[model samples]
Target: MLNVLSVLIGLFALLFMIPAFLPFLGIANWLLVPVALFGALIGMLSTRNSGRNFCLLVAAFGALRLFLGGGIF
Candidate 1:
Protein backbone atom coordinates (compact mmCIF):
# COMPACT_ATOMS: atom_id res chain seq x y z
CA MET A 1 0.00 0.00 0.00
CA LEU A 2 2.70 2.45 0.91
CA ASN A 3 4.60 1.52 -2.24
CA VAL A 4 1.56 2.22 -4.37
CA LEU A 5 1.02 5.50 -2.57
CA SER A 6 4.64 6.45 -3.09
CA VAL A 7 4.47 5.69 -6.80
CA LEU A 8 1.34 7.77 -7.06
CA ILE A 9 3.17 10.69 -5.54
CA GLY A 10 6.11 10.10 -7.83
CA LEU A 11 3.73 10.12 -10.76
CA PHE A 12 2.41 13.49 -9.62
CA ALA A 13 5.94 14.85 -9.58
CA LEU A 14 6.61 13.32 -12.99
CA LEU A 15 3.81 15.33 -14.49
CA PHE A 16 5.65 18.44 -13.50
CA MET A 17 8.99 16.98 -14.54
CA ILE A 18 7.84 16.56 -18.11
CA PRO A 19 7.13 20.22 -18.51
CA ALA A 20 10.21 21.25 -16.56
CA PHE A 21 12.41 19.41 -19.03
CA LEU A 22 11.67 21.85 -21.76
CA PRO A 23 14.22 24.49 -22.69
CA PHE A 24 13.98 27.68 -20.62
CA LEU A 25 12.01 25.66 -18.02
CA GLY A 26 14.80 24.17 -15.97
CA ILE A 27 14.04 26.43 -13.03
CA ALA A 28 10.91 24.42 -12.44
CA ASN A 29 13.10 21.50 -11.42
CA TRP A 30 13.73 23.29 -8.14
CA LEU A 31 10.13 22.51 -7.29
CA LEU A 32 10.28 19.01 -8.73
CA VAL A 33 13.15 17.89 -6.46
CA PRO A 34 11.29 18.47 -3.22
CA VAL A 35 8.20 16.73 -4.53
CA ALA A 36 10.25 13.76 -5.73
CA LEU A 37 12.13 13.67 -2.43
CA PHE A 38 8.86 13.62 -0.55
CA GLY A 39 7.73 10.72 -2.66
CA ALA A 40 11.04 8.99 -2.01
CA LEU A 41 10.49 9.44 1.73
CA ILE A 42 7.11 7.74 1.51
CA GLY A 43 8.60 5.08 -0.73
CA MET A 44 11.30 4.30 1.83
CA LEU A 45 8.60 3.35 4.31
CA SER A 46 7.41 0.58 2.01
CA THR A 47 8.78 -2.94 1.96
CA ARG A 48 9.76 -2.95 -1.70
CA ASN A 49 12.64 -0.96 -3.16
CA SER A 50 11.09 -0.26 -6.57
CA GLY A 51 9.09 2.77 -5.51
CA ARG A 52 11.91 4.24 -3.53
CA ASN A 53 14.35 3.75 -6.35
CA PHE A 54 11.97 5.18 -8.87
CA CYS A 55 11.43 8.29 -6.80
CA LEU A 56 15.13 8.71 -6.30
CA LEU A 57 15.71 8.42 -10.05
CA VAL A 58 13.11 11.09 -10.58
CA ALA A 59 14.72 13.32 -8.00
CA ALA A 60 18.11 12.74 -9.58
CA PHE A 61 16.81 13.91 -12.91
CA GLY A 62 15.44 17.05 -11.31
CA ALA A 63 18.69 17.72 -9.50
CA LEU A 64 20.73 17.07 -12.63
CA ARG A 65 18.56 19.46 -14.57
CA LEU A 66 19.03 22.14 -11.96
CA PHE A 67 22.76 21.60 -11.93
CA LEU A 68 23.16 21.60 -15.71
CA GLY A 69 20.86 24.56 -16.18
CA GLY A 70 22.27 26.49 -13.26
CA GLY A 71 18.86 26.71 -11.61
CA ILE A 72 17.48 29.00 -14.31
CA PHE A 73 17.06 28.34 -17.96
Candidate 2:
Protein backbone atom coordinates (compact mmCIF):
# COMPACT_ATOMS: atom_id res chain seq x y z
CA MET A 1 0.00 0.00 0.00
CA LEU A 2 2.78 2.38 0.90
CA ASN A 3 4.62 1.45 -2.25
CA VAL A 4 1.55 2.22 -4.30
CA LEU A 5 1.11 5.52 -2.54
CA SER A 6 4.72 6.39 -3.20
CA VAL A 7 4.38 5.65 -6.90
CA LEU A 8 1.20 7.69 -7.13
CA ILE A 9 2.86 10.60 -5.38
CA GLY A 10 5.86 10.36 -7.67
CA LEU A 11 3.57 10.47 -10.66
CA PHE A 12 1.82 13.49 -9.19
CA ALA A 13 5.19 15.15 -8.75
CA LEU A 14 5.89 14.59 -12.41
CA LEU A 15 2.58 16.20 -13.26
CA PHE A 16 3.50 19.12 -11.06
CA MET A 17 6.14 20.04 -13.61
CA ILE A 18 3.45 21.05 -16.04
CA PRO A 19 2.65 24.17 -14.06
CA ALA A 20 6.21 25.38 -14.39
CA PHE A 21 5.63 26.10 -18.05
CA LEU A 22 2.17 27.55 -17.53
CA PRO A 23 2.56 30.68 -15.52
CA PHE A 24 -1.18 31.13 -15.31
CA LEU A 25 -1.36 28.24 -12.90
CA GLY A 26 0.06 30.50 -10.21
CA ILE A 27 0.63 29.17 -6.70
CA ALA A 28 -1.04 25.86 -7.43
CA ASN A 29 2.32 24.45 -8.44
CA TRP A 30 3.82 25.07 -5.04
CA LEU A 31 1.25 22.86 -3.37
CA LEU A 32 2.74 19.72 -4.83
CA VAL A 33 5.96 20.02 -2.85
CA PRO A 34 4.29 19.22 0.42
CA VAL A 35 2.45 16.32 -1.13
CA ALA A 36 5.72 14.91 -2.43
CA LEU A 37 7.35 15.44 0.94
CA PHE A 38 4.48 13.65 2.63
CA GLY A 39 4.94 10.74 0.26
CA ALA A 40 8.66 10.66 1.01
CA LEU A 41 7.93 10.57 4.70
CA ILE A 42 5.49 7.71 4.28
CA GLY A 43 7.97 5.88 2.08
CA MET A 44 10.71 6.36 4.62
CA LEU A 45 8.53 4.72 7.23
CA SER A 46 7.79 1.77 4.99
CA THR A 47 9.83 -1.41 4.63
CA ARG A 48 10.20 -1.18 0.83
CA ASN A 49 13.48 0.41 -0.13
CA SER A 50 12.50 0.93 -3.74
CA GLY A 51 9.42 2.93 -2.80
CA ARG A 52 11.40 4.94 -0.29
CA ASN A 53 14.07 5.81 -2.86
CA PHE A 54 11.52 6.65 -5.51
CA CYS A 55 9.62 8.93 -3.17
CA LEU A 56 12.84 10.58 -2.05
CA LEU A 57 13.64 11.28 -5.68
CA VAL A 58 10.22 12.79 -6.17
CA ALA A 59 10.68 14.91 -3.07
CA ALA A 60 14.02 16.08 -4.42
CA PHE A 61 12.47 17.08 -7.72
CA GLY A 62 9.70 18.96 -5.96
CA ALA A 63 12.21 20.73 -3.76
CA LEU A 64 14.30 21.64 -6.78
CA ARG A 65 11.29 23.10 -8.50
CA LEU A 66 10.31 25.07 -5.46
CA PHE A 67 13.84 26.35 -4.94
CA LEU A 68 14.46 27.27 -8.55
CA GLY A 69 11.07 28.87 -9.00
CA GLY A 70 11.27 30.67 -5.66
CA GLY A 71 7.83 29.43 -4.77
CA ILE A 72 8.69 29.07 -1.09
CA PHE A 73 11.19 30.89 1.15
Residue 59 deviation, candidate 2, in Å? 2.1
Residue 56 lDDT (model 1): 93
Q: Model 2 segments beyond 4 Å from truth?
A: 21-26
Screening candidate 2 with a backbone cut-off below 3 angstroms (N, C-alpha, C), the clashing residue pairs are: none
TM-score of 2: 0.68
Per TM-score, the best of the predicted structures is: 1
- lDDT measured at residue 48 in model 2 versus the true structure, 0 to 100: 85
How would you encode candidate 2's per-residue C-alpha lDDT over 1-73 as one tens digit per residue?
Answer: 8877887786787677566545545355467667777777777777886766776776676666666657743
Q: Can you write out model 1's per-residue Cα lDDT over 1-73, one digit (the tens) per residue?
A: 9999889888888888999988998888888899989989999999998888889999998898888888897
